[model samples]
Target: MNTNTTIKDIQIISLPRIEDRRGNLSVIEKEVLPYEMKRVYYLYDVPGGAERGGHSHIDQQEFLIALSGSFEVVLNDGEQETTVSLNIPNKGLLIPKGIWRELKNFSSGAVCLVIASDVYLEEDYIRDFDHFIKSKNS
Candidate 1:
């Protein structure tokens, strides 16, 4: 793992692999999926320079992977900041709750897979940077 490009101090956990000639299978089910996966979504066909997340979740946890092409996920944990560039299908960055995250610098044809711990809810999101900073400490 690259320290400078780390999203968090928690070493990014790589998903387990199950190889096969027919079709390699990997599961992201429940608590067995490295970190418990509660929700899943994928971002695709993104235009150049378009950003995805510009907010932070109050309690939801997430793990993001580049299923195809490449992109960067910038993370801020109140004080320090880090940027992670993911370009591998099998590799993922686990983002814990309370961290402000923004997804950007997406390469054309990039496909991002996100596994989250909670369903989509507008109320669960902290879209304001000021609120995120305040909530990080609270």
Candidate 2:
């Protein structure tokens, strides 16, 4: 974990929204993120009252968008915490590495689109809170 990083480092990035008579479209280009996107995935069909993402990344950064419904992202930085609600399709939450995060309070039919800075690696995740805290202190 990066001790210098805190909850204050979390950012909400807005994408370009082009409105048309038929519908609206949002685009995410190379310049939209601090890191190059190497992977993409989404979460859907989440049951009510359930949660996801109870871990912290070692070096991976991610941008999450609520493409359909709404959800709350609870972020914790060893000593501080914050919660961000994502509900707009054109807006996203940019989460840097070293911050602990959990996704919860998802509305029915919610879709979470995630653009990752790197491919998935099991060793890159700190799955335990105690371990994450220790890494932050180290």
The candidate scoring highest on lDDT is: 2
C-alpha displacement of 30 in model 1, angstroms? 3.1
Candidate 2 segments exceeding 4 Å error? none
TM-scores of all predicted structures: 0.82, 0.98
Report, for every candidate in turn, its global Cα lDDT versus the true structure: 0.77, 0.96
lDDT per residue as tens, model 2, 25-136? 9999999999999999999999999999999999999999999999999999999999999999999999999999999999999999999999999999999999999999
Q: List per-candidate RMSD values in Å.
A: 5.0, 0.7
At residue 95, give the lDDT of candidate 2: 95
Which runs in model 1 stand beyond 4 Å of their true positions? 1-10, 19-25, 34-36
Q: Name the 10 consecutive residues with the lowest summed lDDT in model 2.
A: 1-10
Indicate the residue-level lDDT of 132 in model 1: 75
